[model samples]
Target: MNVFGMGLPEMALIMVIALLVFGPKKLPEIGRSLGKAIRGFQDASKEFENQFKLEAQQIEQGLNTPTPSESEKIAPKEVATAEVATAESNNHATTSSQQS
Candidate 1:
């Protein structure tokens, strides 16, 4: 079998070297630690991918959904009309009083 582009022979050689260096007793502990590290890395990578996807989805939804323009965010037309009418009336009242 091939792993990381290394054939069985290459894998066997590395294992032999590691066993000789660490000895049989320490080898299992090292293997367990290596396995645990790999598992933890995989879990962290998956979590990061999931988080990235969730954020991307949120951004996509935000883009798809409509936002209010400047005019839409402002007060409605009816209120604006009423305010203008009141100002005009006040101007008229002022002019009438000035004439009197």
Candidate 2:
């Protein structure tokens, strides 16, 4: 609804006031400090996000794994073999019944 969320006249007035209050000598210093603070905040936030992601990944892997201190793992191949053995026994029983 307004330029820069403020009236153009209001922005000009604020600029004039800031120029008078801080003067040319201090505005550059203020800008520099503000830039540094923004950069530091960005760096810190990125580091926090990276750490959180790493912790989440570690938790996921932990949930998917069986360690030496935990229960033994069941491999897919072993499961498949067990299933095949059960099916073979069932077939043999049916074949023997048919023969008899």
Candidate 3:
């Protein structure tokens, strides 16, 4: 059997080295901690992936949905024209008062 491109013999050599370095007493503790760390990392990665997907979906939905325009609620062109007319009227009134 192969694991991470390493054959059984390579795996045995690695295990033997680890056992010699750590001794049998501490090997199980080290293994437990390593397993826990891997599990935590996997969990974090999955959570991040899920969050990214959710955000992407939200962005896609936002892009697909049409936003309500001011023109839909109120006549934008009319409102703009009204504003311009009011400004012109105010300028005329000011000019007349200044001449008088």
C-alpha local distance difference test of each model: 0.96, 0.88, 0.96
Q: Give lDDT tens digits, candidate 1, residues 23-69.
A: 99999999999999999999999999999999999999999999998
Candidate numbers, best lDDT first, in rank order: 3, 1, 2
Per-prediction TM-score to the true structure, in the order listed: 0.73, 0.53, 0.66
Per-candidate count of clashing residue pairs (backbone under 3 Å) = 0, 0, 0
Candidate 2 lowest-lDDT run of ten = 66-75
TM-score of model number 1: 0.73
True-structure RMSD for candidate 3: 7.5
- Candidate no. 3 TM-score: 0.66
Encode model 3's per-residue lDDT on 24-44: one tens digit a residue. 999999999999999999999
- Candidate 2 per-residue lDDT over residues 1-100, each given as its tens digit: 4876898889889878888999999988987998999999999999999999999999999999966542235566678899999999999999999999
Full ranking by TM-score: 1, 3, 2
Between candidates 2 and 3, name the one with more favorable lDDT: 3
